[model samples]
Target: MSAPRLTLPSPAKLNLMLHILGRREDGYHELQTIFQFLDYGDEITFAVRDDGVIRLHTEFAGVPHDSNLIVRAAKQLQEQSACPLGIDIWIEKVLPMGGGIGGGSSNAATTLLGLNHLWQLGWNEDRLAALGLSLGADVPVFVRGHAAFAEGVGEKLTPVDPEEPWYLVLVPQVSVSTAEIFSDPLLTRDTPPIKVRPVPKGNGRNDCLPVVARRYPDVRNALNLLGKFTEAKLTGTGSCVFGGFPSKAEADKVSALLTETLTGFVAKGSNISMLHRKLQSLL
Candidate 1:
């Protein structure tokens, strides 16, 4: 008989605010950021295999199977748990690559959480998140599946319930490399950390914006266009720019106007990731 299949949502996230506090000797930046999920993102499906043979049926044109976060996460969990089981993975890609929306990281987290359930590993969130940190700084937030305030290379997380607003997100035609943005000499490395609980309204900003805007014309154009409608902000080191609206109707109006010039979409922001909600329902 065929193995049971489980499909799950892999939600995207926005860095509501990102501040670079300093650079570490380890070459990772010391960051202070707020992370919140979007109602929209990619979807993943998994089928278990008794034999140890990890595989991803979906193909991402430029990303190799070995390098894909889904594969890496699955492998990490398998090794850590010494599980004899493997998985057949498939993804329905929707989130734009290199958009700073945490697409890859979210996928990795979903795989770890999903596999843990399927394989019956029963790892706690803290343990899974620690394993996720080895994959990427953004992975833990997705693993924890909550909106949070992050510091110290983006692994230190403190949950926060920020306003759940509707956002009009514009996707630029070009891809912005996070590495290129961080390595640039012009990028700001020191923004005094905010020391307030729940982070006061509009208390933070992305320091990478100045450098990102100067380097990617498509990103700059999208930002300029959206800024005309609302306070457009760059999420993380972005190729995507977004602005929040008080309602879905308001966000849709802005998205309609901008879609004429750029590719974009509208989604409701959430303090709790959709992935966690689904997992909870299953339990």
Candidate 2:
């Protein structure tokens, strides 16, 4: 095992609220969203090599090796940084794909960050984050190591510290296609814009929830189920629903029952993102 035994985490995110404001000249939606990092997520490990090879090992069967975001992210980093080492990336994926949780984007962000250190490229957070934005809108937030309020195609970020930590009853189920949700003409694109100001000290709304539930029964069911336990809301577009609890024990109890009823995970919310603190620890 001569390769650098590097391990990294790609944490899942929750959109505390999603507000769709309008459409852009680029055909992208203008929006506002509050991003929160989860305690539960996926892990990845990679060792450096000079063979110019990128490899990914996972339980996820049938994904094309070249198409895997982790591999592609590593290659992109290597190419742009002109690093001399190749990477063998290993992803221990736990987050649901296509759930609007930003799992894949987080994976890509982790790849970009982990390889920078393993390859000893010494790029700063801002540089890596800029590169990450090129990969995906969500990637930049993860790379910046913050749970943020995002706008302007989601690259613009302003980190906010939630007044208190939260408990999340996150539904894990069939992945939903973001493209489908975004392309739906029925999707809300005309919600009035609200200026971001410290999250208004309370729960906000997900503008896409109604549209998503109509198309995905799982989400509708989950929403109904979760609403009884706590005020649950849909995160991002679809496939995952979340409820906020005031206490961890209460959330855990619900999570245990939810685990039996539905396949999902319960996690704590943090004011500080694990990815940022994780990297800071290394230095």
Candidate 3:
């Protein structure tokens, strides 16, 4: 008989605000960011295998099997925990790659949580998040499944309930290379850290905007178009730009107008991830 399978939502994250404090001696930048989940994202399905071989049935062009975060995450979990079970993984991808939407990192976190459940490893969130940090800076937030105030290369998390708004996100038809953005000599790396708790409103600025806009005209154009409707901002080192509205209808209305010129979607922002909500329902 085929093994029982579990499918979970791998929700995308918006870096609501990203500030680079300074560059560390180790070549990693110290960052302060707020992460919030969108109600929309890709979906991943997993099934256990008796053979100790991790395999991902879904293939991404140019991303090798071992290099894909889903496969790497599975292997990392299996190796770390010394679990004998393996998993067959598949994904229905909707999130754009290199759009600054955290698709790959989200996939990795989903793999970790899914395998942990199926294998009955019983690892806690802290342990899972620690392992996830090794995979990517953004992975721990997805693993923790919360909107957070993240610091220290995006691993240190402080749970904060930010106002959930409806967001219209525009996907520019170009990929933004994060490494390129960070390495650019003109990039801002000196934003002062926020010392107060509950970051003030109007703190949604992303320091990478000027550099990203200068590098990618598509991103600059998207920001310009969306800015007419609301306070449009770039999320992370983005090729995707977003603006929030008071309601879904309002967001959709703007999305309709903007998407006529550029591709985009409307999604409600959530402090709690849709992935965790689904996981809770199963209990």
Each candidate structure's TM-score, on Cα atoms with residue i matched to residue i, is 0.98, 0.94, 0.98
User: What digit string (tens of lDDT, one per residue) describes model 1 on residues 59-163?
Assistant: 999989999999999999999999999899999999999999999999999999999998989999999999999999899999999899999999999989889
Better of 1 and 2 by TM-score: 1
Question: How close is each model in CA RMSD to the real structure?
Answer: 0.9, 1.7, 0.9
Clashing pairs in 3: none
- On lDDT, the stronger of 1 and 3 is 1
Compared with the true structure, all predictions reach lDDT values of 0.93, 0.80, 0.92
Tell me the tens digit of each residue's lDDT in model 2 across 1-283.
5767778778888888888888899988888888888877888888777788877867456678888778778878889888778887777777887787888899999888888888899898888888888888899888887778889878899987764455555565677777788888888888876667757556478878888888888888888887888888887886888887778888878878777778767677876668767878988
lDDT of 1: 0.93
TM-score of 1: 0.98
Model 3 — TM-score against the truth? 0.98
Per-residue accuracy of model 3 over 164-238 as CA lDDT, tens digit each? 999999999999999999999998899988953766696568999999999999999999999999999998899
Error at 148, model 1, angstroms:
0.4
Clashing pairs in 2: 49-86
Q: Judged by lDDT relative to the true structure, which candidate is superior, 1 or 2?
A: 1
